[model samples]
Every structure is written in C-alpha cells, then in structure tokens.
Target: MKKRLIYGWLLAGVTFASSCTKNFDEVNTDPYKATSENFNPNFLMSQAQIQFSQTGYDQLLFQSMWVQSLASTFDYYANGDKYVLRGSGTGYYSRTWNRGYGALTLVDEMKNLVQGKTQYSNLDACGTILRVMFIQRITDLHGDVPYSQEGQAKSGNVAPVFDKQQDIYKAMLSQLDAATAALDLNKDKPSSDLFYGGDISKWKRLGYSLMLKAAMRLTKVDAATAKTYAEKAYAAGTMTSVADNAKVLTDNANGNSNSNSDALLVADDFREVRWGKTLIDIMKTSNDPRISAVAEVSAGTGKAANEDRATPGVNTASLQIGMPNGYDLNGGATDISKAPNYPGTSPANPAVPNDAPAPVGKYSRPRLTVYDDRSGVNMLYTYGESELLLAEAAVRGWNTGSAATHYANALAADIRSLAQMNATPQAVVSDNDIASYVSRNPLNTANTTALQQINTEYYVVTSTTFNFNETFANWRRSGYPVLTPVTYPGQYITGSIPRRMPYPITLPQTNGANYQAAVANQGPDNFATRVWWDKQ
Candidate 1:
C-alpha cells in the first residue's frame, strides 16, 4: 500500500526517481513530497510520538532505568539476578544524546509541520502535545538541554547551548497549555490520527492527561503551581477505560507480524537484566496477579518474595543482586545464554539467537518480560498514566475527583493490561486475586501507603518500557520502588547510591559558563547529591 506523494517541492539540481512519471519536467519533485503524503501522516505522527521509546532513543533513557543508575550504569534483570546496569564504567553519554536529545529530531518535525496549519489543527495540536511531552522528558533526564536551538543543526546550531532544566520546563508547560487549549473536538480530524484514528475527543483527553503529568513534575519544587495546573488538567476530560489507552501499532521489519509487548520488553534488555528484590516483593505481596507475566520466578523467588504474600509490602522481593551492566560484553550467543539464571544456554532459533537476535528484532539492548512485544508501537500516553496522575492530584487535594478510585483504577488498568502474563501456567488469577489485593492493601485513598503502591506500580510499569526515562522520573519524585546501591567491582566512591547523572563530559566546553552556574546552584558537582525534587 505504498501511496504516491506530493512532488512539488523538490530541489532544482536534484534528480528525481519515479516509476510513474514520463520525464523530469512532467511530474512534481519535492524533497519531502513523497515523505509528506505517502507516509500516512498517522504513521509519521506515531513515529514522532513513540520517539522516546524507539531504538533511536531507547538506549539512553530506557537503558538507564533498566540498569537503575541514579546517574550511571550497572547490570539489570526482571528477576534481580546480578548487579548494575549493563555496560558500565562510562556513563551513557552518547546513549543519552540519542534517546533524549536525539528524540527531538522527530518530535520537532511534528512541531514544525504543525505550525500555521489551520486545516490540520487537531493533528497540529496532537503533535504539539506529544512534542512537549518528549521535550520535558529530555530536559528532566539531562538537566539543561538545547531547546530553542536544537533541531536547527543544519542552520548553524551544530553545538546548541544547553537551557536550564527549570527554564525548559517553563517553556514546555507553556506549550502544553497552548496545545491543550487548542484541542477542539469540533476541529477537522486528520483522517490520519494513528493514535486514536481521527477521534478528536480522545485527542483532547490525552492532551489534558498529559498536562496533568507535566504539572505533576512541578510538585516537588512548586507544589502550589503543580496543584493549580493539576486542577486545570483535570478540569479537562481524561481516559475512562483501557480501550482509550494510547500506543502505536508496531510491526516487525519484514513487517509481517505483530509481536507481544514482552517481545520488546524481554528482547535485548533481557541480556542486561535479571530482577531486583524490591520489585519481586511487591508482586509477591499482593499475591500480585502480574508477577508471572512480568518475571520468571527464581527457584526461591516465590518464597523469597512472600513472607506473608497477602501483605501489601509483601514486596517485589529484595536484593536481586542485579546483573552487572556489561555482563555480555563479550557479545555472543554463548555469553547472553549462560546468564546463570537462564535455564537453557541454547535457544530454539540460533540465527535469531540470544533473545530477539539480529534478524528477528535487531534490538541492541536487553529487555524485561513486561515489554514482551517489541512489535507494539511506542506507548505515547495511556489511561493508566492519566489515572495515576489524577490519584496523585487527589492525594494533594488539588482536584475534586476521588483519588482513591483513580488509584484503584490505575492499578486495575495495569493488571488487566498484564492479565495474560500475570496468570500462571498452573492457574489464572480471577476475582479472588483482585479482591485479596484490595482488601489487604486497604487503599484508604488518604494513605501514603496507597499512594506509594500506585507510585511503585508507576515505576515498575514505566521501568519495563523501552528505555527507562519515566522510571527515573518517578524514583526522583517519590522514592518508592526502592533499589539497593550497586557495588561495582570498580572504584567504590563509597558505594554510595548515585542521585544524579553528572553533566555530560562535553558540557564544560559546550556551555561552560551556564553549565558552571547550574552546577554552582545545584551544589556538589558530584553525582551523589539529589536533584531539586528529591527532598526526602
């Protein structure tokens, strides 16, 4: 189904290639003409939307969380088998550049295409919202980033100045507000909205929901402003069910089949990760129906995670002894296979050996089981995320909605989302599983414990995504889903858990004065110090 594109914008000197045209002067020839119309704008939009989760972007943010470095790397796992995120020693400077800043390449495209287009206002609005989301995520993870000048690289921004994280947020929030306000269900549908397929109402809902998320980011430093913005976002409608969950429709390369979320989840990071004890305990405690879906229980994981499994703190388990970050440095079928935790050293399809393998998925990093399907498109935003935002808002009395109900809804959405994987080979968890969790946990809606549960859920669900940008965000804000310090065989640095990733090595030369100023304001150029948000 390859569609022809608009060829009116091609350059004068460029030679055009085409099967349909008779001659060069006969047909149109624009550079992005084919890219613009043939691309199924929906697909293009989705590509931008999922940029943060894409291969082009995964290694930095996603890999960071998978490895659980406050600022650096260690190994990883769903079962918490070893220690540190994969490929340690050097912090992921390039990885961050791609996943975070690199993501802007696509997101900015969406922004530029939307400018001044009244006909595609809905699409434009949607693009703007997503663009802001990606931007905020980037700055949040990497402190200051080049915002205004980023993407203009060809026009002389080869080395853009880094904007402060605080300033970046301010700009992002402004954009989000504009996007939200611009959302009009009455506006013409793009007929190409891949996320919701021309559903303006859905787009509107997502915009508001994203607003809540952005606003929530300010909670630590500016609670009053956070609450004000939170209220505004809630006043706008939000997702009410799982059907409204927003994710791209990802397909395999030969592009024939649709894989499961876990395919992507357990794909590469699978090599890098095992599991952490804290996550194991949480799943086991609630008799968590999703445990089996997310992780393979270690020989003693069930017993180890369950002191009193019915308990809320029942724990995701403890001290998983996560794998070292670069455990598979040798990079071979044999290296990835003999993880010590994996049951068989040899896989069924060796060509596609060691997880998704080369020809299969082409994923460079390891993955967790939760993202089982690499084929599923990037999850731009979801109802589950919206509800959690609402729950947090309600907790703060920022809005009038029932926070408890939203909290429960948030948990329920993930459970249902993971229901299949959650069920064991022996038996599927039914109403009994849900009831047991709710009763024992006793979500008072008013309790920090309830909030913590949801926050923890947010971290796990987020941690299981493509690369772990959001997972780190939650960790900084709430301090839940506790992870132990990584004791790398390298320099100890007192084995102190890292609090912030150091500014990239290039920053000193690139934006020396501003970078120095930020460091001074932030106090302690060392990674051990917390960010502005981590008061606790």
Candidate 2:
C-alpha cells in the first residue's frame, strides 16, 4: 500500500505524451496529471478487479491459523476439557492487517474506474460485488472494522473509524443486491475471471448467495433479520445448481495461482496443526469418502485404526492444540504433511496435500477446505449451501420454502458438486459409483435424522477447501452432527472452545478507541468471547 505503487499502477494504462522540452534541450512530459479520457475502461477495470479479488484468496490460505485450527470441519484444538481458539498465535499478522486491507485499497481504485462512465455501467456491477465481498470479509473477521472510510487512508485521515458489524452487514447486503440487479446479461465484459470465466449469471448468483450467507450469520442474535435476508435472497434466485458455484483458480504460476503447500511443512508453527478426531470418526462411521479425501492413508495407522485419529503432535511449545474448531480425538493428532498426498497423490491427477508438516517431516494428510484446488477456486454459494440454509431456516420456521425438498436438494447438489471435484484423471468417480451410497448414507429425514443429514453435509460444503467456517458456525447455531471434545494443554486458551478470534496485537496502535471499546463492551475480546451473532 505504498503511495508510490498505488500511483504508479493507477496510471498503468494511460499513455504519456512527452513534451518537446521546457528549455528546448531537455525533454519534458505532460505533468498536467493524467485523465481517464484515453484509458481503456475494460483493461483498467480487469487489472484492478483481479488484483482486488486475490485479497480474499490470499488471506484465506496464506498460513491462516485461526481458520485452519479454529474452524476447519475436520479439525479441533482443546483447552483442557473445553475448547478454544489460539488466534493470538504468531502466523497471522499478514492476514490480520496486510492482505485484507491491501485488497480494500485496490477495490477503491476499481470503484473509481467505472464510476460515471455511461458505456461501462455493467462494469459497475462487477466492481460492486467484489468490493462488497472484501468489506464483508473485513467485518466478519475483525467485527466493527473500518468500512466506509477505508482505502481512503492517504487523504490526511489515513486512519478511519470503525463501523458497527450489524450496520456493515446491512450496507453490504444493500450493495450486493443493487449490483446484482444492475448486471446486464447481454453485455459482454471480461472473461478473464480467475474464478468463473467472467460468467455474470454465476457472479450474480454468488451475490445473492452471499446475501443469504450474511443473513444466516445473524441467526443467533437476529432471527427476523436472518430470515428477511434469506427470504429475499431465495426470492431473488440464489444459486440453483452446482454450476452456479463461484471459485478461485490456482495454477500456481508464480507458484501460479497456487501456494507453496510445501513451505509450511518446514515451519514449526504450521506443522503443529493436524486433523481433529471428531470429524474423522464420523466419516469412518458413515464410510464417507472424504475421510481419505482429507487425511492420508490413515485407515491402518495406529491413530486411524485404534483411536480413529490422525494425530500430528505440536511438539513445539509455541503452538496450541484442541482448536475452537471442535474435531479432535482422545489419543491422536492431525498431520499437516497430508496435503501432498491427496487427490494430488499421483503425478497424473494433480491433487494437492496442502497441509504442512513439522521440521522432523513427521505428519499425515491435511484436511483441506472447499477451495483447496484451482477447480475449487469457485466461490461456492451453492444450491447445496442454499438448500441446507433454507432447510435450517424452515426447521426454525423462517418461511421461505419446503424444508423437505430443500433437504433433499441440499444432499443432491453437494454430492454432485463434490463428485465433480474428483473428476480428475486418477481420482475420477463413476456416476454409478456412489449413487447407492448417497441414497442410503444420508437418508432423508424420517424424524430428526433429516436435520442431522442436512447439517452434516452443509458443514462439509461451507468450506471452500473443507467446512472451515461452516463447521463451527453451524455447530454453534444448531448443535448438530454431535462431535466429541479434544485433549490439549490449557495455557493456550481458556477452558473451552474460544469463539471470537483475539483482536490482533496491533489493534492498540491502529484503531485504539474502537479496539478498547470492544474489549470493554465484550470482556477480554478473546476466543471465549462471542461475536454479536453467536447468541449463546
């Protein structure tokens, strides 16, 4: 976010006409300040938007610990008998401050590019959705972060005040709604989408789907608001099929669109995290394929067969265990080195075992989020997610559609989407392969069985790589798909699963007043303290 880089890039496309010479001997350039008159709106818009979109992509993966340890569907870290998050751990500085805020800076430029241009009104739709996604990410992670005044940092008020989380959600919903409504279907913009090949309909679906997700986030403290947004999004036609899912491509060119999945294995901090037992056992009990899909060939290992866990010890004193995510077992640990063996186990299919191992190289498979691969880059606000949300909404009697049909559709969509991801060469699954299993494993609700089925699958799909955010959030909301507790040292966090991520260490210097006020209003502001939406 240096002033020099922003200015230099801001003028990326505009050409300069060199003035003949101020003294008739030395060359002078037109310094009247460049205008947008000659700039190609399409080119400028693409670069700006693409750069901005990468913020979420980068933060979600870039050695993020809170998400991996605290929220992954298949992992857990315990604080004695209770569980808690260790968000205060050291690896998160870049995510907490840099990538997210940096992306906001670019979004500001994108918004300016399409602003009063008559011919490029459709481009506004594109900018609006991406910007809102960034803003929501900021609010979701930090809660009450600077929204309205962010990215305007250089304008004398480099530090902007914080906005309320509730108000931020409302504004973001408004922006998503407006932008989706404005997107022109016939107008061709750019297909260079690193996620979805410039598919406007898919983008719009994601807009509405994200609106549902935002609304769903408030179910604890504000059911009425949650239902309102869910209903509106449902009526607005959110994701109806797997094809509509949004994603981010990872070619790993500079590492392409990929991360150095290998780099983390060497870091003590990174390898300390491993899979939790709660989810591992469940996958085994139901005979779910995702178990092998996530953890390495743990079936015969001591942890897998005996304790039914793939325990990766965090031998380093610095790392914490039993994450707030809630998926650990009594005797085993998860392995980070697992990422290298997955769908990427062979040279043919290109599956990645994205998890990192300890310096000793002792580890197992990684529990990847939904967006673990390039194909997974699609931002998935899926029919599966929508159906599950609706089913839950219906279970609560929020009133949008039929809970039964929604439940069934949720399963079908997720199964289809999941199966599609394995379509790679060596890992392909035939259509006739799992049809029998799907029909039986998650039988439609006879009594409360349907609720369990819906929530369990729902948890899995919410994660781009695995069910990272959804697992914790859904478990907190409905108390479903019952999981067991993990065993770990308590000094890392308080006695139970900590809820909110600890405010970054830098908060004291940056947004002093708001940071202090949050701690005052909400005790300690650690993992134990819940966000506004986490009702209990």
Candidate 3:
C-alpha cells in the first residue's frame, strides 16, 4: 500500500509529452508504473497527509526560536533568533513557501479526481480539510498569497493573482463548512488514510476544530464573525478529549521517523538549544509539574561529582534552568548562569573566555528522549487547544461551555498529552499531579486578568508541545505573557518582535505583476507589516 502511494506521488509530478510519436506502442509504456490517468485517489491522499505533516513540523524548526520557546546557541540561527531577515538567498522562506504550495497541488489533484463521484465524496471532503490546513499556514506567514488561482499552472495560469487575507479566510471557512457537512457515513473510507484511518466522524471533528481555530484567528479584526463561527463550530462537534487529537503517528523506520527527532540528531551542535527563560520561569513560579516532563537537568561541570550525567541530561525539575534570548553564544553563557534565582546544577563563570565554547549543556534543554524519540507522534490539533479556545469563546460571550470548566479541562488535557507523548518513566504525570495542578491554578474571575491568565496558560501549553506557530499567533492576537522585545546588535526589526515573514524572493521574477500588487496592498513585503487578522 505504501509503495503504491509512493508510485502515485512520483507519477503526479510527471508531465507527459503532449504529442505522441508514430513509434509509440505497448513496449514504450511501463505496465507496473502508475500514471495520472490510473492513479488512486487514496494514494494521493496518503502522500498529501505525509507532506502536510512535514510542512507543519518544519515550521517549528525556526518559529519556535522566534517565540522564545527555544534559544539557539549556534551562529546559523543567531540572526533568525534576533528577528533578522536572512535575505532572498536564504532558503528558509522559499523552502517553506514551496512545501506549502507543493502539498496544495497534490491536494488539488486529489480533489479533482474524487469530486462529483459519490463513492469518493468523503475522500474529497478530506482533501478540502487538508487544503484549508495548508493554505492557512501560508497566509499566516505571508499575507495576500496566490489563493484563488493557485495550482492552475497546467491550465496556462502561471501567474495567479494574490487574494486578500480576509477573502482567503472567508473562502476557507465556507469550504470547511461544506466539506464537514458533506461527510457521509455510508461512503467507503480509504484504508491508507494517515490521520484518521478513513474515519468520517474523526474527520468531521477535525474539520470543526480547524474551523474553531480559524475563527479565533479573527478575534482581533472581526469579533462578530469570530463569535458566529465559534458557536457554529461547537455545535458541529469539536475535539473534546486527547483521544480525538488530530495527529500523524510515526514509527522508528528509516523513512517514517519523526522529523523533530531526525533534525535533533543531525543538528550542528547537539546542545545548541535550551529551554527559554520565559517558559521555565513561568512554570517554576506556578509550580507547574509539566516542567519536569518537558525539560532535563543541566549537565554543567559545576555539578556535584555524584550527579547523574545522562545523555539527555538528568530529570530533576528543580535543577533545570532556561537560557535567555537575544544574547550571543559567549554572552548568553555568561549572563544566564548569573541571573537571579538561577537553578542549574552547575553555575558557570560570570565572564567566560571569549574563545570558550558555548555553555549550552550547562542549562536545561528539552527532554531529549521524548522530543528526539523516533516513534513520537506529530500533533496537528489537540483536545487541549479545542478546550482553551472554548474558554476564550465563553469569555467572548459565545455559546460554548463554561469558561471555568473548559479552562480546567484544557490544563488536564495538556498534562495528559505530555505524559502520553513521552512514555519515559521519569517524565510520567500521575493523576494526583494533574489534580493538584488544576486545583492550584483555577481560572480567575476578574475580567481584567482573565484573558491574560488564559493566554499565559496557552503560552505554557504551546511551549511544552513545541506548537510555536500557534503560540506566536496567539501572543500577537491576545497580547498576553507580556514578553519584552529583544534589541540585539545587527537585529533587523529593532525595539519590537517581528509580526510576519517576508515573501520569497522568487515571487517578483515568477509572478511580477501579481507580486507587485500584493506588496502594494499588504504593506511593504517586510517582517514589520501585520496580517489582516493582526489588526492594530
């Protein structure tokens, strides 16, 4: 089945010659190879799912640094950490853009193949859900993208016009509504489905959850629409527990391993990353037990001789400390160890030698065994996120459940999710721990601080799960956690954090007119410009 999926994917990229030769005969064609005419929609769907997972996971590699969930000690990401644009020559922006649009093409093909066919209506609905997921990420990163006419290159529409972010959002919401409603239980399901295993109910829940997410993104710009969709989503049935989470399960096989684990193993410096101070300090002050589940104790030389020096570091919660953002390797190494309430097992010199190696391992890093585990699951949407959004919806006077109940459920779900993802004995979060944490952190009734508290908890939840894209977007929308802007030397956007990534450089060359229009409509193609949803 997997081999067929791969063959179909390969064939999807093939462009056969329009004119056939007189010599064309049976011997000229390969009988076993799949082609566009004979490709299975199920195989195409499977490939799309895998590519979508890869695209989403890759965003964390850099966006996590932007949100301060993880600090980079390596020079390669120093400029990115400080919000500096690496220029058109840098592949980060272009690579992400290509991956998103590439996946959309596969999805478009799958939808075209299955549409108007009753037997494949459910599969077509899945394609719609996948389309929304991919396009949303693109518009979020680079406002005013080629949406309405995208994936029409074969039809001679190479330079597709860019659509406004508002229009894109509206269209996506409508498509999701129709797609979820079109799901029929009587239809045949694809056995090769990667996310829900061809289960229509799970896909329906995911569609509603995605709709809720889209609605929340509009809170800053269009509260009325946000409220309307939020209510509809709840009624449509959103994810309510960890069991309903939309994730792509991966194995330890060579080509199927988790992307995060693969990247960690191949990173230039094994310890280039450490827990960010913003996250660790919040966890410590609140006595959050999930902190131990996420981080490992420092392995600095200053620790006691008998201290455990495990490969991923020790699992002592009290001994974990996070690295602060904005400083260079040497500066961070010296400054972090001297900060007030430093909790690392080892304390480094207040001033280290200029030539000394970065003291990254001296500070706490993410629990390696779990984050770098080959068989880990890649979460797309979670019950915790759904509950948190419900809490926000209630606060907004929407017809969701009680804010307090949703808040508590969100916390419990987050804790359970952490333990479930990482089965290490030391990282376990027992029922007692969840109960104690929930009891200690009840929702505040004061309206003034209620939103702040809710979003702050969201920041912590996203940090632990490495869901930095949503974390950054939420921070922009709610303005919670009150993070200080970094003002490092050579920074591109000074005095404030970046709001959006610039468009890829190839845009002007390939689609000049449309690109110019988009740039003119959406402020200068720069990081400082805000998207439509991020209203001032």
Candidate 4:
C-alpha cells in the first residue's frame, strides 16, 4: 500500500505523451504503466492528501514561531522568531502559495477524472473537501489569492485574478456543505484513501467538521454567516471522537517521511528549535498534562549531546523550561544568555573538538522520540479542533452543545492525540492523567474568559501537533494567550506581530495586474495586513 501510494505521488507529477505515428498508437501505450484513462483516480486523491498535508518548511519558518509554539535563536528561523527576513526568508514567503496551488491542481485533475461518475462519486466529494480545506489555508496565509480560476493555467488562463477573501470563504462553505451532503456510504470507497481507508461516513464527518472550521473563520467578520453554518455543521454532524481524526501516517520506507520531522532533524534546527516559553508557561500554569508529553530537556551537557537525535531526553514537566523568542547566540545584549531566567549554558567537553558551551541547551526541545520520527502521523484535522470549535460556538450562544462538555472533551482529545505522534503508546500521557487535567481545568463560566481559555487550549493542541498554520490563524482570530510582539534589532514588520504573509516575491512579474489589484483591494500585501475574516 505504501509503495503504491508513493507510485501515485510520482505518477501525479508526470505528463503523458503520445506518439505521432498513427499506426503505432497501440504499441506506444505501455500496458504495465497507468495512464489518465486507465489509472485509478483514487490515487490522485491520495497524492493530493499527502502533498497538501505535508507542510514542511512552509509553516516552520513563519507560523510555528509566529504563534510562539516553537522558538529558535537560530538565524535561519529569524524570519519568524525576530520578524526578520534571513536565509531563504524571501523564498519561504512563497512556499505556502506555490505548494498549496500545486496540490490543488492535483485535486482539479482528480475531480476532472471522477466527476459525474457513479463509482467515483465518493472520491470526487472527498477531493472537494480536500480542495476547500487547502484553499482556505492558502487564502488565510496570503490574503486574496487566486481561487475562482485557480489551477486553470493549463486551460490558457495562467493569469487568474485574485478573488476576494470574503467570496472565497462563502464558496468554501457552500462547497463543504454540498460535498458533505453528497458523500454516499454505499458508493465505492477510494482504494488509496490516506485518512480513513475510504470510509464514506468518516469522510462525511470530516467534511462537516471542515464546514464547522470554515464557518468559525468568518465569526469576526460575518457573524450571521458564521452562526448559520456553525449550526448547520453541528446539526449535520462533526467528528464525534478521536477515532474520527483526519490524519495520514507517513511511510519512511517508501521515502515519504514526515516533513516536520525532516525539518527538525536538520542540524541547525535540531540544536536551536525549542518549545517556546509562551506555550510551555501556559501549560505549566494550567498544569496541563500535555506539557510532559510534548516537551523534554536535553540529556547531557555540550552541543554534541544536545544535538544528538539518538538519545532520548528527560520529559519531566518541571525540568522542561521553554526558550524565549527573539534571542540569539550573537554574544551581545540580545543574546539568550542575557534573557531573564536563562538556563545557563551546558558544560563544554574538552574531549569534543570545537565544542563550546551549548547556549540555550537547558531549555526544552520537542521530545525527539515522539516528534522527530520519520514515519510519524501528520495530523491534518483532529476531533479536538472540532470539539473546541463547537465549544467556542456554544459560548457565542450558538446551538452546538454545552461549552464545558465540549471544552473538556477537546482537552482529552488533545492529550490523546499525542499518542498518535509517537510509535510507542506507552510514552504518551495516560487516560487517568488526561481525565484529572480536564477535571481540574473545567471551562471558566464568564464568556470572555471562556473564549480566551478555549482558544488558548486550541493554540496548545494545534501547536504541539505541528499544525502551526492553524495555531497562528486561531491566535489572530481569537486573540487568546495574548502574546507580546518580539522587539528585535532590524526586524521586518513595524513593531507588531505579523497578521499575513506577503504575496510571493515573484507575483509582480508573473501576475502583475491582478497582484496590484489584489493589493489595492486587500490593502498592502504585507504582514500587518489581515485577511478578510481577521477583523479588528
């Protein structure tokens, strides 16, 4: 199955060509290899799911640190930690846009093959859900992106105009609703379904859950639409438990390793990236059980020990200190050593060549065994997210369920989701621990406080799962776990947390007219500018 999925990924990228000789048409076609006409469209859906969900450096360089879920003093991460453009920063700005559209193109091809075909009905619906989920991410990151005519370049419409974010949200909601309604359990299931093994019922839950998510994105900008769809999504049904989580298990044997793990394993990233103080402090303050599950302190002294991926770290919650953002090892005023409560540098080993005291070594990095697994699960969406969204909706007086019940459920689901990140189940938080934590931290009754608590937990859950894009988006929308903007020398933004990533640097040359128009309508294409739903 893994090999076949890998083949699908490879095949998705190829463009088939035919021989000019009319008499040799039959001979030209390879019987062993699959072509569009004879290929399984489900493979396209599988490829789309993997490509869209594997958000490697795309989110790592920005969203991860923007939300202060993970922090780094590494210069490469300065683009996010210090709000400054460093190495590959300019290129990173375009990753989400380019990769997202590329995946959407696969979905478009899949839809083209499967649409209106009875046997492919479920595949088409699943593809639509995948398409909307990804398009939402693209527009959320780079506001007013090409949507209406997206992926139509092969049809000679290469310069598709950027659609209004408002219209895009509406269309996404409508498509999600229709797709959820269209899923038929009796129809054929996609053979290469990465999420649920082509269970149409689960796909229906995911579609409606996505509807709930898309609806919630409109809460600040358009409350009426938000309420209507949130209610509809709830009524239609969302993920009922962790069993309904939408995730894909990576296959390292097939060269499809977890992208987050690959990025973290990079030597520079391995040594510097730590769970941020903002996130760890919140968990510690709340006595959140997940703190120990998600974080760990390096096992020994010196740079070599800290960067060693083979040795497991201690995950005692008390020892897990988070590194603050916007500090570096530049040996100056802004050095991490100068920060308050800075864990002193690890001892330098005389035996190790060129080994200096490992700066920021005492601070917590993501538990290597759990998070750095090449074949770890990539969480696309979770039952925790669905429940939390419902909890927020309930707080706003929408008919979802009891705010406390949903909040508690979400908390438990979030903790349980950690087990999925690791290969060994014994390394995860226990059910007793999860239950106790949920009991101790029931939803605060006051509406505003409740909102803060819910979204803050949402931030923790998504961040720990490495769903950094969603973490950043929800933080922007809910204004929870309020973060102070990092003030670093030579920063990019104007003394504020960035709200949106700028358009790809090449947009002016590739699609100048539409790019200019989008900038005009959506405000300047910069970090300070918010997307349509991110109303102040």
TM-score per candidate = 0.70, 0.72, 0.87, 0.94
Best by TM-score: 4
Candidate 3 colliding pairs, count: 0
lDDT of model 1 at position 180: 72
What C-alpha lDDT does candidate 1 achieve relative to the native structure? 0.55
lDDT of 2 at 206: 78
**Could you tell me which 10 consecutive residues in candidate 4 have the lowest summed lDDT?**
13-22
Q: Whose lDDT is higher: candidate 1's or candidate 4's?
A: 4
Residue-wise lDDT of candidate 4 within 12-73, one digit each (tens)?
64523223345466767678887667878878888888888888899999999988998999
Which pairs, if any, clash in model 4? Answer: none
- Predicted candidate 1 versus true structure: per-residue lDDT over 312-336, tens digit per residue: 2211323122333323334454243
- Tell me which of candidates 2 and 3 scores higher on lDDT: 3
Mind sharing the TM-score for model 2? 0.72
lDDT on C-alpha atoms for all candidate structures: 0.55, 0.53, 0.77, 0.89
Ranking by lDDT: 4, 3, 1, 2
TM-score of 1: 0.70
